[model samples]
Target chain A: MFEHLHAGLLAAVSMSNLIALFFGTFVGIVVGILPGLGPMVGMVVLLPFSFAFSPDVALSLLLGVFCGGYFGGAVPAVLLRTPGVPSSLVTSFDGYPLTQKGEAQTALSAALLGSFGGGVISVVILIFLAPALAHVAASFGPPEYFAVAVFGVVLVVMAFREQFARGIMLLGLGFWFSTVGIDGTTLSERFCFGTLSMQNGLDIVPICLGLFGIGQTLILVERDIMKTNDIKLSRSTLDFSAIVKVLKYWKTLIRSGVIGTFVGLLPGTGSILASFLSYDVAKRLSKEKERFGKGTPEGCLASEAGNNAVPAGAMIPLLTLGIPGDALSAVLLGVFTINGIYPGPLLLVKEPVLISTIYISMLLINVVAFLMLIIWLRPFAMIVKVPGKLLAVVIMVISMIGIYAVNTRLFDAGVAIAMGVLGYILLRMGWPVVTLIMGVVLGEIMENRLRETLSLGDGSLGILFQRPICIFLIVLTSLIILIPFVLDIRKNIRNKKLNQF
Target chain B: MPKKDYYSSRAHDLLGSIFGVFALSMLITSPWQVDTSGPDPFYKGPLIFPLIVFCLMLAGSLPSLWRLFRPSEKSSWYLDGQGKPFKTMVILGLLIIYLAGIIFIGLEVSTWLFLLIALKLVNQDSILKLTLIPVLVTLILFVIFKYFLDIWFPEPLIMEIFLE
Candidate 1:
């Protein structure tokens, strides 16, 4: 392990890797500080270039974007009451209040420090935990793999408890989309419609770019971009004292980081869940609970720490089991497969140096993002003042060009436009979009694995129950589904009784 | 009790109705459209998954479509094209033209013209910004794509007719 780390250090420090780290982090910060454009969009835009670069350089670039996005999201949340990423919405709860109370500098400092601390702890957790998990996962058979996929789907379904049916419906939609291409097991055209493009099936890059990049732009353009011109950052400046002041909440930082890492380990639970969970836990633990929403720096710290830890924590399953936790990691998985680097149990053994380099790169990405934010927090906040329309046009141009540049297929451009339209429609609807995309991403694995398991059992559903892992997953998913459903019924009944009285 | 358009939910319902129609169509047409023949036909059976998907979609959409027709105040009966949709349509039209431009005119001129029109439409009234931003953006795009990455854009259709 130590030898691998040493070799990883050497590879991570190569000029190309360092350049990618800097450039990716820089792009990530800019994207994160901008509303509606998060790390995923930035990563997708950089995806084309990734195909050309070495694995270390490409992974570092995307990793930088992923972690740097979280680090930078807190800026707008702190100063402008606008969270650059959804995960930072929790930050604004306390952060914006601090801004109003003339303590923007302290809020920003605390958020950044918490992010730095969380990032470090997450890497530590990844180092210690991932290998053990990989070792355990090495014994998994098709039944277990099939069970894990189902478990992953259920985990995501449980995440969107508020919109249960819609989440599932969208997931089904994504699954259908995944099945559109030639069947992996059968090599039969399911819905090719006698077209060559349809015969080849859909690629994730174009779909993702269209959905996020183009779709997000269409939404942003409908509003006045210059409306944020009134926001001023004159009084909101950071100092060394702010850092010292933020460190006083070391307890919150550590707790949130651990909570985040644990939650992140759960498949399908992304950074937002981590942030919300950590913030809620901190609120429950704090003696000054009343002060939480009213500019409590600890609240800001917990949320940032929680969200920042997720990328590394999520990387574990991705490295060990080849399962991605969220859209961002799914895209990372896409990149890995495209590069002929399949991440599973064998990955740890086959590419120890590559894996370790990624680990080392993750740690450096956090530090680089932290230092950059500290130095340029002021200029970075200024980005929020840019007109939304201008940014919209920019997304349109780049996404269109980026999609075309990848393989130069005109049909891909058509697919992107169609996807962009679909994405816009989905976004406009109250229906959950993530589930659909996840369905599309994870659907193929579930379909193939489930069919394989069934075929092994001579097409008997009872075969799933024969395996301990599959039985455990089935029971767990049942409980997860049933508990909330029973509780909802009880709540409704109690409400009816109260109305009768 | 008109349902607030929040998140374009009514539009979602409209799409739901469409999905219902899609499911119905697929159920009727799968015999012709889907080809499930292969080795281990049971394992390779493509129809099984689609059947499951079709059932899920119908189950999810039927209730929503029923709700759409029930005349309830909790939802709208029609889709409200929203958020300066006219502007959005115009821009979408411009996007279609831009995409067509890449195939017809070539990458260079198309990008510049598209940017120029798009920047102007977004209310950048300055001649300098309109002119300079396009030139710079086009140059950067050209350099990065053409010179740096060496991607080949579709040749202009006119190249076939003209002696170059």
Candidate 2:
């Protein structure tokens, strides 16, 4: 394994791959800091380019985007009081407040250093642990995959803190949307409705862009009035002392990284869940819990660690089961397929070098992003100083061109427009687009897995629980779904009694 | 009831009615087809999920509908000092119009035109800044799609003549 790592490191750090790494990380940072354009959109826009390069080069670029994008989310969260992605929502809690108090550099430096620490820890874990995880994942069958999918749906319910009915409704809607394309076994189309585009079902990318980017942008556009009474950021940022302070918070980093890795390993549990859970955990464990929302550095560390650690953690499942762990991983899976490499347990044995190469590349990607963040730190801060309207126009133009550049299909452009509008409406109604997009992204894979599991029996229900892994997952998912509701009910009951006095 | 409660109830009812209408529409317009293949449980297996979703939608919407007709005691809604919900509604309305235009005029033209109109209506900026920024942006997008990324967009009818 050490020998393989040496070889992989040599191959990954070749001049060309390094250049790709730098370029990809730079693009990712820009995309991450820009509102509405998250890593998935960046990946999709760059997916077609993957076809033009070797699989390793492709991974380098996209992985760079994935890693850099996670850290990039902190930029806006700190400076503009806007979270570039849902995962960065926790960042803004303390981040924006810190910015208001004229310590933007301090907040930014802490987030950057925290991101690097959590990311490096997870990468080490990914390196040593991914191979073993692959061994465990090798035992998984269709039933196990289905169970995992079930677990994912349950996690979505927990992660989404909105109305229970609405979340369930969205899940049902996602399942329905998943069934749009052709059936797995029989060469039959279910809801094609005679449209060629619908036959392929909905592409998760356009739908996601429409929902998060377009929809959120419209909401921002509508509520265009600036809310911040004052905007001030100290440009003279010092890192060494700040780094020392953050290093003392290793317990926070480790806890958040573990939480992030666990969430990432779970199919469909993305960084948003990790960050929120980490923030909640940090708050629960902190000495100064009351200071959390009012600009605590611990809050910054937790949120940054939570979001940045996700990509590495998410890569575990994708490399192991070929079941993408998140939206970005799904696109990466597409890149692997396009390159004629199917990622699964077999991939560990057949392409051990490839696996190690990716791990090593991820390590380098973070380093490159760290360096780029340092070089571009001041410019990034200046980015927020631009008027909101100007920023919107720039994002709009980029989105249009990016979408057009990818497929060049007018139909796809139309699809994006439709999706954007639908997304905007869903946002206005307070519907969680993450759940909807998760459904769209994982719909086909889950359906195929479900069909495979169902076919394994004499059509008996016993097949779903026959596998020990499946049974364990089934139990886990059931607990995930019920625990929150039970807690909420208990809290309500206790509160009612307390108020009665 | 207080006058504020009367308006709030009306708003709740309107929301409930909208969902109720949408739910009903799904039941009516869901392209339910007959599967003529072997041992069909119902004529339409495809319709099952949609029908289930519609039923759930109707059921879920009931609380909002009930609140519209009868005031609820358990809930409280807050308003800020200067916030006018009606103004927010109008802004939302303008956004809907801008989104609708994306479908008709295409993304570039629609977005550019929307920004111009939005700036004019909202007094967000001077005409010079608003007008110049849109075209500059449109060109940047054109270069990105056409040159940088090699994405092909259907030139808007206005640009179609000149570019072609």
Candidate 3:
């Protein structure tokens, strides 16, 4: 492995590869910093250009964008209290609080370091464990996949432990939305109501934009536009001390990275779930759990690291199984196919040098992107000082344009506006929108897998119980859901005993 | 002194439950059926998942409706304080107008109008700054999407006239 990595490093050091990496990273960061634009969009926009370059150069460029985009979203999340992408939503829980406390520099540093650590760690994991993990993933049959999907959704609801009921309701709504399109198995339209557009179901992009972007804009508009002068930036640009402080939570960084990689290896579970699950796990492990949503560096670190790890971890499945882990990897799959390099079980056997080059390029791009962000930290931080009213207009315009640009569909823009209104209402009611997103992400997978499992069993429900992996997942899901309630009951009982005394 | 608790009206809860019930009724009554002809004859139709969701929604909303009738202390439904409802309504109204404008007029013209209205609602910026910012933002977006990314938008009446 080390020998291959060395060969890859030698291949990746060419001037053309380096230049492509730099440009891709630059574009990725810019795209990520803008609300409603994510790594998928960045890759999609640049995909045409990939046809012009060699496979190694093209893959390096796209992977650079993928890595940089994940980290770039954290910038807006920490400073502006707006997540540039769905995964960054977890980052903003504590990131925005730190910003409000005038520690935006500290937050940005932690985010960058966490992202860098995650990227490197996941690449390492990908290098060593890709074959083993892919074998495990390949064993996941329909029942196990269904169980995993259920587990992911349950984890999302559990992430909002205080508001589990509300989360469940929102998740149900998300699942319903997912079922709106034509049924894949039965070849029947479900909830289109005769509309051609609705037959395709709701797009995740518009939903995200409506919930996070437009919804946030409405709140800013209602707050009377926060004044730019009110925000005070600290003297330091990239705080080494703050970075050191975050490093103290090395356990959290490592754990979240591991969690992210494992989740990313799952074909359908995306980075959004990975980050949320990581944040939840971090909070559960923290001695100072109360500080989690209130400017805790640990929260930001966990989320940033968890999401940043996904690019490499996602590659594990794409390379070994010919299965893209998520949307971005799906796009990368197309890029690979276009470049005449089909990734499957035989990929490593056939194209060891090319695979190694890709790995080395990823490592270099991750480091370069982090360094560039640190150098440009001050300018990024200064964006928050833009007049809130002006920023609001900018956000709205960008969101509208971004939604429209996705498929050049006016219907998507309308969906975004409608969702924006719904999100605003839900926000006012203190409902968890993140859970809804998770449900949408996992719902189709669960439904389809469940149907497949049932069909395989000839409609016998016992098939789920018969599978060892499914049983294990079911038990894990039950434990995760039940442990909190059990803890709450124990706390209540102890309090009652004390009151008796 | 102990903190005083304020309770909001149960209107939202009532409406939510009503919507759930309505959705459930529609799901039950819908004629669109799933094709179960392929091999698996016993497979429940496509309506099953949606029906399950509506049922869950109904079940979840029931407690909220019950609490509404019982008159318990709750936070206010309004996100901001009094008089902000008007502001929210105005913003939502503008959003609706913007959507309509995008369809009828075009992206550039609609975006310009939306920004001007939205900015005026949110802040008391100078007319020149507001005008310049919106026009520049619209142009930059147009260039990025239309010229660079090759995304298409309906040509506005004004743009058509200018081209002619």
Indicate which candidate wins on TM-score: 1
Kindly list the per-residue Cα lDDT of model 2 for residues B2-86, writing each as its tens digit: 5454334344345545666677676676654312243423312344445655676577566666765576675444322223435
lDDT of 1 by residue, B26-74 (tens): 8778757778656556554887777777777777787567766664575
Kindly indicate the candidate among 1 and 3 with the higher lDDT.
1
lDDT (tens digit, per residue) of candidate 2 on A153-231: 6666556654555555555566566666665444456667677777766555455555555555555555553334244
Q: Can you give the lDDT of residue A366 in candidate 2? A: 80
Model 1 steric clash pairs? A225-A388, A428-B7
Q: Would you list the C-alpha lDDT of every candidate in the order shown?
A: 0.83, 0.68, 0.75
What TM-score do all the candidates reach, one by one?
Answer: 0.95, 0.78, 0.72
**Candidate 3 residue spans exceeding 4 A from truth:** A1-115, A224-365, A497-501, B1-19, B30-44, B73-85, B157-164
Q: Say which docking band candidate 1 falls in.
A: medium
Q: Give model 2's DockQ, 2 decimals.
A: 0.21
Any idea what lDDT model 2 has? 0.68
Clashes in model 2: which pairs? Answer: A405-B151
